[model samples]
Target: MIKGLFETHINVSNYEKSSSFYEKLLNIIPLYEDRVRKSKFYWVGKPGESMLGIRENYPSPLVQRQHFAFRVDVEDIIHANDYLKALGIESTNFYGDSPEELMVFPFMPAVSIYFDDPDGHSIELIAMLNDEPRTELEIMSWKDWNQLHTK
Candidate 1:
């Protein structure tokens, strides 16, 4: 059986631009760079825990966009939108709502923020909460989700 997600790869048009964005946004140092293949790899979450591979796209007209999320601290997820906005990146809720809004997944009772990379791929920052799942609640704004627990 599969154990866990070791690494995920995405094709970027330019290695220099994408790598620089990730470096500045995440402050992650690349672990390896394949000069011949023009691929760069970086550790995510932590070293040896997870990895992200970014490959420079070949000369092709069509592009395939993929979605992925990075597991982060609850506090980080809460402040992600603002943090991203400060970097000139825009974030949205699950419903494409306000950038200041965050999405709460009822099934997992987790919080997340959705954003796009330079290549137009959907990327997310998610944090699993310690609270029990509220499946009946479906999805809601983070504020509403918290209010339910506070009452």
Candidate 2:
């Protein structure tokens, strides 16, 4: 019954600020907004592929933050660091290494980078690589992953 993820929600301290940050970074236009409740929703990709909801109901410190990722094209993942840099967003490896340290996961055979939204939630842009999983490779930089495949 479940083919894929359809929707997910996260908490942000302020609706307007969080919405604006997402709008500028992701270039998303929310489909719905509740002014009184301070809630906003946006389609992460195609209208029905997935929905991302941002709620500004996090008034107390007890509210736990969240993390989410958007699947993108491999090319997009490769260039995301530069794109994020231009927007003044710092991208990093899982280890908090350099921004150029794009990541490759052998288990999932995917490439991705890590960054943060205004609310400090870990945001990732990932793309499945067109390769078989080599569990022995473990996790490493994208460049290293490619070199091994070439050899």
Candidate 3:
């Protein structure tokens, strides 16, 4: 049976630029690179863990965009927003709302913020607010989430 996600591949126009972006975003250098491939590629993150592979696009043109999320500390989500802002990056809510807004799923008790990469890929930083098990999925505004938490 399959265990878990090992790695994910993202196609990019330039390996160098994409690798550099990941290096800064992940705060870690690539773990491996293969110059032998027709289209250059590099791997980031630790071995056995969920890693990311960025590959240089060949003759194929990028037709569709992609979206992915990273699980982060509850507190870090806020800090990450500020960090991205400092880097001149803007974030948005799940609904593509204000940059200052955060999205909350009441059932999951999770909060999240989203931003786009240079290639226009949607990236998200999400944090779980509670340890309770989720029985259903529910989306709500930040205001509603906060109100529920305050009760």
Encode model 3's per-residue lDDT on 6-64: one tens digit a residue. Answer: 66677777677666666666434467787654233333345456677666664365724
User: Model 2, 56-134: lDDT tens per residue?
Assistant: 8655544475778889999888788999998888889877898687879899899888899888989888899999998
TM-score of each: 0.91, 0.92, 0.80
Candidate 1 vs candidate 3: the TM-score winner is 1
RMSD of each: 1.7, 1.6, 2.8
Query: Higher-TM-score candidate among 2 and 3?
Result: 2
* Pairs in steric clash, model 1: none
Query: Which one wins on lDDT?
Result: 2
How does candidate 2 score on lDDT? 0.83
TM-score of 1: 0.91
Q: In candidate 1, which residue ranges exceed 4 Å CA deviation?
A: 58-61
Query: lDDT scores for all predictions?
Result: 0.82, 0.83, 0.70
Top-TM-score structure, candidate number:
2
